[model samples]
Target chain A: MILDVDFHSGVPIYRQIVRQVQRLILSGILGEGHQMESVRDLSGRLKVNPMTISKAYSILESEGLLQRRRGIGLFVAPLAESRKASQSKALFDALLSDVAAAAVQMDVDLPQIISGLTEHYQKIHSQKEK
Target chain B: MILDVDFHSGVPIYRQIVRQVQRLILSGILGEGHQMESVRDLSGRLKVNPMTISKAYSILESEGLLQRRRGIGLFVAPLAESRKASQSKALFDALLSDVAAAAVQMDVDLPQIISGLTEHYQKIHSQKEK
Candidate 1:
């Protein structure tokens, strides 16, 4: 998985790293029991501080997405992959509420957002199927 | 608008305030040139420190969503109401990309998400149309 960091995006670097790792894990690119790169290695590769990399790793670990073995490296949690579906569902619901509220405020009918989602869903599906 | 703060949500209080305020502004509940409640008043009402409220206001002001008048108070920016549409679109696009990436990893069909969105959109539309 590629780690791309946008230093000027206004989002904190540690958060950017955390999000990228989450995306990689959720996408199955990093499966359960997969050992993660050492904080030193990742920091070197990403040109970020080792402390920042460990901060991201520690947060993910605290969230139960990763686990560290004593005197060993961190690995993906066994349940992490299975949890993605529910996690994504929760994310969808929360974002949907916000979007729906904004749509109502803009005088945009729900049909428009539905249609927009349908279009994007189809586009993504077709590309993936190919 | 009522301000509800959750003290144990794990999210920073200042960020929660910012998101709530943004939602209000985006939903048109707060319009251009609308004078916001004084920071002291909001802090008192929300039972939060005045510094936290000021921090949220300062961030929003830096983002050009609010304007500070000398010796007066912060008011919604003239362009904020107009900017919501574009901001919402950008938000939708970014979230859609993340959702799509996760969906592909899960092997969930596009039809599933589209159908789910259709149901939600209809539900919201019918209630709003009542």
Candidate 2:
């Protein structure tokens, strides 16, 4: 249930929350059926409005990433497990499209872009490991 | 001089214009000393407010990407050529950071991510050639 928000980022706070929560679910960091933090709790913790948190949660629910149970709370939807691979692929494809667009626009050839990605990947990977 | 804006996107239209124009300059599509279209003309062509285009151009001017030549018109800053490499590197680094963040969050392994990038790069490169 780890979440963070940057008020300064131009992106809306609710969208940021939705994206992070979606990523967490897709990554299996938040397993299927795992209960989500209450909206009040998450709002207080992130210092965001409760309505904002609720808006994010509702969006996730509409996307089938979260499920609301009677009186208990929201939990990661069971369907998330089966849809994980496809969802992850879609996410990666969108990311790669952005990278390719930027790389081509910058005149970065394939080899250079690949090498740079490798260097960055290793650096971030090592940092995460540590 | 080619730019497009998506009003439905959560990102501000002025920022979108700025980013596209920045990419055009950095990629050498808009060479140094190339005259920019008049704000009014560009606004009319893009069907956006003249002030929005002005805002974007002014931001670029402040960043030294565009320069105003007293009554002549705006032109690509001559400093752009020498700064291209460093600016391009900075842009790629930021882009790579985003990819790495998304990959790590989605539990995508380094090898898989590299392969995905390679496939995507080839696809985009070939499309550009066509």
Please give each candidate's TM-score: 0.66, 0.88
The candidate maximizing TM-score is 2
Local accuracy of candidate 2 as per-residue lDDT tens digits, A58-120: 999999899999899999988634579788689788888888877876678878877887788
Q: Could you tell me which residue pairs clash in candidate 2?
A: none
Evaluate model 1 with DockQ and give the value.
Answer: 0.27
Off by over 4 Å in 1: A59-72, A80-109, A115-130, B2-6, B9-12, B59-64, B67-74, B80-88, B91-109, B114-130
Question: Against the unseen true structure, what C-alpha lDDT does each candidate score?
Answer: 0.74, 0.85
Provide the lowest-lDDT 10-residue window in model 1 chain B. Answer: B99-108
Tens-digit lDDT string for candidate 1 (B1-130): 6555789966789987887677667656788999999999999998999999999999999988799997899999877434786875665555555555545544556676666655665676567677
lDDT of 2 at B3: 71
- How would you class the docking of model 1? acceptable
